[model samples]
Target: MKIGIIGATGNAGSAIYKVAQQRGLDVTAIVRNAAKAREVLGADANVIEKNAFALTAGDLTKFDYVVNAFATPTAYQHIDLAAKLVRELRENKTTKIIFIIGASSLLKPDGTKLLDSLLQDENAANWIATPIEQAKELTFLKLIDNVEWLAVSPQANFVPGPAAEYQLGVDHLLFNAAGHSIVSTGTMAEALVDQIENPTVPVRTRFTVGDK
Candidate 1:
């Protein structure tokens, strides 16, 4: 499969990039810095450096799936980037899109939210995370009626780990018997690949990753 990963140099993205190659899937690392991504993600795949939001239909002819792990350092840029990508994806119909969304949009037990969980504290790690953009992206993506897309929302706590045997859920929280929220990056990547191969989140649908 020809997969294009945006922001393919970050932690989650880099992990996906590595696994894609290990699976022998043809992949492209889309980012601004070819040198840095080649250093972090290493070489052996196609490197497409440029913005996807502004990419014309002619430039969108290479890949079959686009996983957007890209995020701007600032809040405004984050929203803009996501919004533009959604618009472009709606316009450009050449590739299937699998967005690497944040878990901030996940709801908590008390009916609050994971995104606002750290809203009170300015120093919380999730605060600076990219959920805000994910929320906006979700809103924009929901409006498009005829697009093949998958928005995979991770568990509450996602860290580097091997793909533990787990269950997959749709549009809801996935919790363990102990009620701890978690999802391995490896398993999440696996699920993302599945959606890419067989889309279930296309056009106003969602999928979740966590233990059941």
Candidate 2:
């Protein structure tokens, strides 16, 4: 299958790109900087130099799936970009859109959202906006009914590391045997590709992954 990765140079996006290549899939990096994409993904990488927001339907329709891994310090841009992509793909269900969202929207065992606990932490102020906007993004996505979209949220602690055995769940926070909620970039990437290859979930729904 053909895939396009936005923010292809970023942590999650880069890992997904590499995993797609390892599977011998036709993948293209839709990034703003071609040189940096080449430097990071190697000289043989196929790249489409363009900003994610500026991408048009013609640009996105070339692939079977487009993965939005774009992240920004501004935080609110997460929802904005998701809205833009949904708007562009409205009523067009051929190319599926996959979003990488934050874990704050996942539910806890007590049926409370993880975001509720995160909001109570004073130390969360430094980077809490991201989770907040990501939660908002998921809410916005849920409201759209026409587009073929799927969202994946990592566990509480997402780190950059190699792939591992993972377990998947729908809209709840998952914990490992030790009770730690975490997942590596590689594991998330692997789950994403597996989902693309064998999609069992319905569109417009969200699922999560965690280290097993």
Candidate 3:
């Protein structure tokens, strides 16, 4: 399958791009700096250098799947990019879009959204905007009914590590046998590619993954 990854230089996106290549899939890195992409992905990597928001409909529709791993310090762009992509692909279901949203949108065991608890942290103000906007991104995505989209959230503590056994859950925060809510980038990438290859989750909904 043909796949394109935006923000392919980031931790999660790089992991996804590398995993896709290891599987021998036709993968392209949609990045801003072609040289950096080559440096990170490889000299042989196929790349399309352009700002993600500047990407045209014609550019995106060429791939069977596009993973939006674009992260920004400007948190509001999280929702903005989602809206732009949805607008570009409205009523066209051929190319599926997958969003790697923040874990703040997941649900706790008490049925409350995880963002609430995150907000209660004393130091949350230091880096709360991204999670807030990501929750908004998911909320906005849920309102759209026409686009073929899937959202995936990592566990409460997402770290840079290698792939491992993982368990998936729908809308709820999942914990492993040791009661830790965490997932490595590689594990998330593995789950995401599995979904792209064999889509089991219904479109327009969201799912989450945690280390097992």
| Candidate 1 structure lDDT | 0.73
| TM-score of each model, paired residue for residue | 0.84, 0.98, 0.98
lDDT of 2 by residue, 85-182 (tens): 98888898799999999899999999999999999998999988999999999999999999999999999999999999999999899999899999
lDDT of 3 by residue, 1-212 (tens): 99999999999999999999999999999999999999999999999999999988899999999999989659999999999999998998899999999899999999999999989999999999999999999999999999899999999999999999999999899998899899999999999999998888889999998999
Pitting candidate 1 against candidate 2, the one with the higher lDDT is 2
Which run of 10 residues does model 2 get worst, by summed lDDT? Answer: 70-79
Residue-by-residue lDDT tens digits, candidate 1, 1-212: 89888888887787788888888899889888898888987765579888656665445547788787775676556567656665666655567677666777777777777777656676766565566667666666667665666677888888778776676776556787788889877777777776666665544576788854
- Check candidate 3 and list the clashing pairs: none
Error of 2 at 12 (Å): 0.4
Supply the global lDDT for candidate 3: 0.94
